[model samples]
Structures are given as C-alpha cells and as structure tokens.
Target: MRVVLAEDNVLLSSGLKLLLNSQGFEVAAIAADACAFLAAVETHRPDVTIVDVRLPPSFRDEGIRAAAQARRDHPGLPVLVLSQYVEQEYAGRLLADTRGGIGYLLKDRVSRIAEFTDALRRVAGGGTAMDPEVIAQLLARGGDPVEALTAREREVLALMAEGHDNAGIARRLVITDNAVHKHIGNVFLKLGLSAGDSGHRRVRAVLAYLRRYGGNAPDATTPHH
Candidate 1:
C-alpha cells in the first residue's frame, strides 16, 4: 500500500521510510510539518498515512489535526497515529467520525515490525487497531465496564479491539468459531452494543472499550499481542 508519513523527527522519519519500504509499503510522501504533510496527502492520496501526534512550530497536535482535516477532505481516509504517550482524548477525536480505517498506537510498538505492519494493513483495509497500552489505560481508569463478562469473554473482546475477527480470535485463543461467536454475543449483550449490525456493533464495542477507561494515566507495560 502507498503511505504518507508525517513526523517531525528527522532520524525517525528516515528510519520509518526504510522500514515501511522493507515491509512492502510504498512511501509516497514524507513530511516534517503539518502543512507539508497535508500537501503530501493531497498530492499522493496514499492508501494510508502514518502520522505522529506532534509536528513543527507548536509541536503539540498539529499532525493529528491535519490528519482529521485530511479525513474531512477525503472521507474515510485511513490513518495510523503514532505517539509517545497514550492520549485517550486524541483517540476519541480520531474515532469521532465513526468511519473506521483508524489506528492509535504508541511509537515504541513500531519496533515489533510484524505487529505494527499488520496494524497498518488492517487500518488501510478499514479496521481499528488500538494499542494494548491505550486499552490498558482505558481499563485502568474505567469502572470495569465489562465486569459482567467471564475471563474468556473479556479475552474475546480484547482481541476484537485489536482488529481480530472470529476466525483470528479463534486461532489465537485456541477456541472454536462457535465458541468465539457465543462469547462475542455475550460480550455485545453485556456491553449494550447489540443494537447494530455485527460490524457496527464491533465498532461500538471498541468505542465503548475506549470510553469506559478513558483515563489519562501513563501506559502500562503489558503487550496486547
């Protein structure tokens, strides 16, 4: 897939371009500032954009704002937000449009190339790829929104937030597809996300997961993969 990368760090930008190229993704454009980033996106219209949360000048949230504007300009544009911290508020904004094709991950996770690339592919293909640390932060702050679920059910829901379908969840958890379905059904019921189509319900469940634990704590050491 073609990609537009927006990061202010010069060394990291070069490294990411090389890494993405090695992983079969075309780096269509790379920019170090918000305006340049938007220009690249407008010019190349890449399949996905990998963006840092900060950028030149203010270096606060310029990149994310640009990404949001890009999505508005071209609805459903895929974006993978890379950040040093787990910012739930930013994540909420990214998903506010409810159009999917979005991801929010900590920058350190990129070192796990296989998982990171898989997340990029998933987001590009119209799926969610939230970081486990972000989920953990959300979980730590929320009042156990999913406390009704059994351990296995919680596991299934967690995998769902990681962009896994029934088949993938089954493979990872060593469960039958039927069992996965049953657990997911129970999850939806418990989370009050049963009112929509399966795809919509999945997105709602993920959103619920995020809002339930939308605390501003530092990320946990736990790995989601």
Candidate 2:
C-alpha cells in the first residue's frame, strides 16, 4: 500500500515514514501542514492517508478539515486520523461521511505496530477502525436508542464499531461465537436495524451509535450500499 502522511511533528512523521516503509507500505509523501497534505493527496493519490487532528496555521482543526476536504474532493479516499485526544466531535464529523474506509485512533496507538497496521489495512479496505477510547467516550454519553442496549450488548456494539468481526469480538470479550451472534442480533433489534436493512447491519449499527455525537445521521431507510 502507498501512504501520504500529514503530521506537524517532525520526529513522529519521520518515524512513521520509516515504520510504514519497514512494514511494506510505500511512503508516497509526508506533509507538515494541511495545504501540503491536500497537495500530496492530489499528487500521490495514495491508497491511504494518515493525518493528525491538528496542523499548522491554526493547530486547532486544520488537519481534520483538510482531511474532510480531501475526502470531498476525492470521494471514498481512505483516511486514518491520529489524535492526541479523543475529540469526539471531530471524530463524529469525519465518521458522519459514512462511506466506510475511515479510522480515528489515538497517537499512542502508533507505537503498537501490529494494532496500528491492522487499523490502517482495515480502513484502506473500506472498513471502520475507531479507537477504543473514542468508542468508550461515545458510549459513556448514553442517550435514547443507545440506552436500550444491555451492558453486554453495548460492549459488542462498541467492538463492532472498532472494525471487529464476530470472531474477533468473541475472542476479545472471551465469549462464545454463538453468544456474540446473539448479542449482535439483540443490538440490531434494539437499534431498530432490521436484517433486511440495506447496508451492512454492523456498519449501520455503528453509524447509529455515531449519530449521537454529531453530524448528519445516515438515513436508516436508505441502503448504505
């Protein structure tokens, strides 16, 4: 895979370039600011992009905005945002696009090579990979619809949002695959996502969870596909 990375920190960007290269991913370009980052996206058209939440010029949300703009300009472009904080609002905005091929992970996750690379690949392959911390934060702010879930069902839904499949969720939660399926079914039922719903039911469930944070919610009646 090819990557265009955007991070203001020289040490982190350089280290990431090396790490990605060593992991068999080509580093197409690295940008320190949003302008350069967008330019690189247009220039490299890389398979994926790793962006920081903040960038130069403002350091508030320049990177996130640039990432959103890049996605707008190049629809379905996979993006993985690295942030020092959870920034649930920003995360919600990005995820609201709901095109799949998205990720939001804490900066510290980069040190865990296996996890980071897996997330990168998952996003690149048109899947979601939200940080567990992000998911926890969203879940903590319980409200209508989501509040209907049992504690175990909520746990399963959280893992599903993190790009885990049934087997993976089972392994992580130390539960049986049958039990995982049961919980997921209950999550779908509680969320009002029927089996006949158009998009991947798991994706829709995650989207419903994300809708509580902010951004336009996916049309539950329409097929995400």
Candidate 3:
C-alpha cells in the first residue's frame, strides 16, 4: 500500500521510512510540516497518511488539524495521528467525525513495528485504532460525559467490547436480561447517543469505546478501564 508520512523529527522520519520500505510498503510522500503534509496528500492521494500530532509552527496539534482537514477534503482517506501522550479530548474529536478510517496512537508505538504496521493497514482498510493509554483514560472515567452511569452499566460496556449481546452480556455478568437492557439504556443515555437510530447505536457505542481505549488495540487485554 502507498503511504504519506508526516513527522518533524528527522531521525525518526528516516527510520520510519526505512522500516516501511523494508516491510515492502511504498512511501509515496513525506512531509515535515502540516502544510506540506496536506499538500502532499492532495497531490499523491496516498492510500493512507501517518501523521505526528506535533508538527512545525505551533508544535501542538498541527497534525490533528491536518488530519481533520484531509478527512474533510478527501472524505474517505485513512488518517493515523501519532502523539507522545494520550489526549482524551483529541481522541474524541477524531471519533466525532465517524467517517471510519481514523486512528490515534502514541508515538512510541511506532517501535512496535508489527502492530504499528498492522494499524496502518487497518486504517487504510477503513478501521479505527486507538492507543491503549487513551482507552485506559476513558475507562477510568467511564460515565456519561453529560451524566453518570451505574457500575452495571459500565460492566455492560466492557462486555460490549467483548462482542456480547444483551443476552450474552446478561449471561456472562449473571444479570437478568431486563437488567442488561436497562444497563444498555443507561450507557446510551450517559454517552449522549440516545437519539441515534437503533441499528447504528451499537456501532456508535463501539466507536465511543474505541475512541476511549483504541490506542491499545494491538493488545486485546482491556487496560484498567
């Protein structure tokens, strides 16, 4: 697959280019600043774009801004935003777009070559990958951003990520089916997803869950969420 990489760190940039090349992935373009990054995407229309959250000029969220802009212009191109630390707010912004094919991972994860490469492939295939640290952060504060949910509701969340349905979650957690239903209600309420269509609620909830704990998908064990 073709990729456009954006990072201001020269050593890391060259290292990543080499790594990707050795792995047989074509490096279609590379940029050191957000402006150049966007221009390259517009020019190359690469299959995926790997971006560092901190880039030239502000050295803040330039990468994030670029990712958001690229998503706006291209609509379906995959974007992976790398950062040194987890920022829940930033992850939320990325997930809010819900166009599929977005990722938010820690910069250090690039060293885990296998997983990082897989994440890029996933994003290119229209899947989400989030950093584990971000997942732990969201799980630690699992509740309605607007309202609090019960412990049972949180348990239901953990089970949802486990690929459980109301019946399955009820059985696994030893709760009544009705109880699981109520917990689902509370989850939707707390997450401010109550008004969405029924068919899409579960997907949205999963997106919220991933947005919360995604940086860690390379590892399945739910971090202390």
Give lDDT tens digits, candidate 3, residues 73-125: 99998998888888777876876766667777888888999878877887788
lDDT of 2 by residue, 13-55 (tens): 9999999999999999999999999999999999999999999
**Which pairs in model 3 have colliding backbones?**
130-214, 130-215, 131-214, 131-215, 131-216, 132-215, 132-216, 135-212, 135-213
Clashes of each: 1, 0, 9
Ranking by lDDT: 2, 1, 3
lDDT at 148 for candidate 3? 60
TM-score of each: 0.88, 0.91, 0.71
Off by over 4 Å in 1: 195-200, 208-224
The 10-residue segment with the lowest total lDDT in model 1: 215-224
lDDT (Cα atoms) of all candidates against the true structure: 0.81, 0.83, 0.74
Tens-digit lDDT track for model 1 on 84-149?
Answer: 998867877775656889999999999999989999999999898888776666555324556676
| Decoy 1 TM-score against native | 0.88
Where is model 2 poorest over a 10-residue stretch in terms of lDDT?
A: 216-225
- Count of clashes in candidate 2: 0
Model 3 / residue 155 / CA error / Å:
8.4
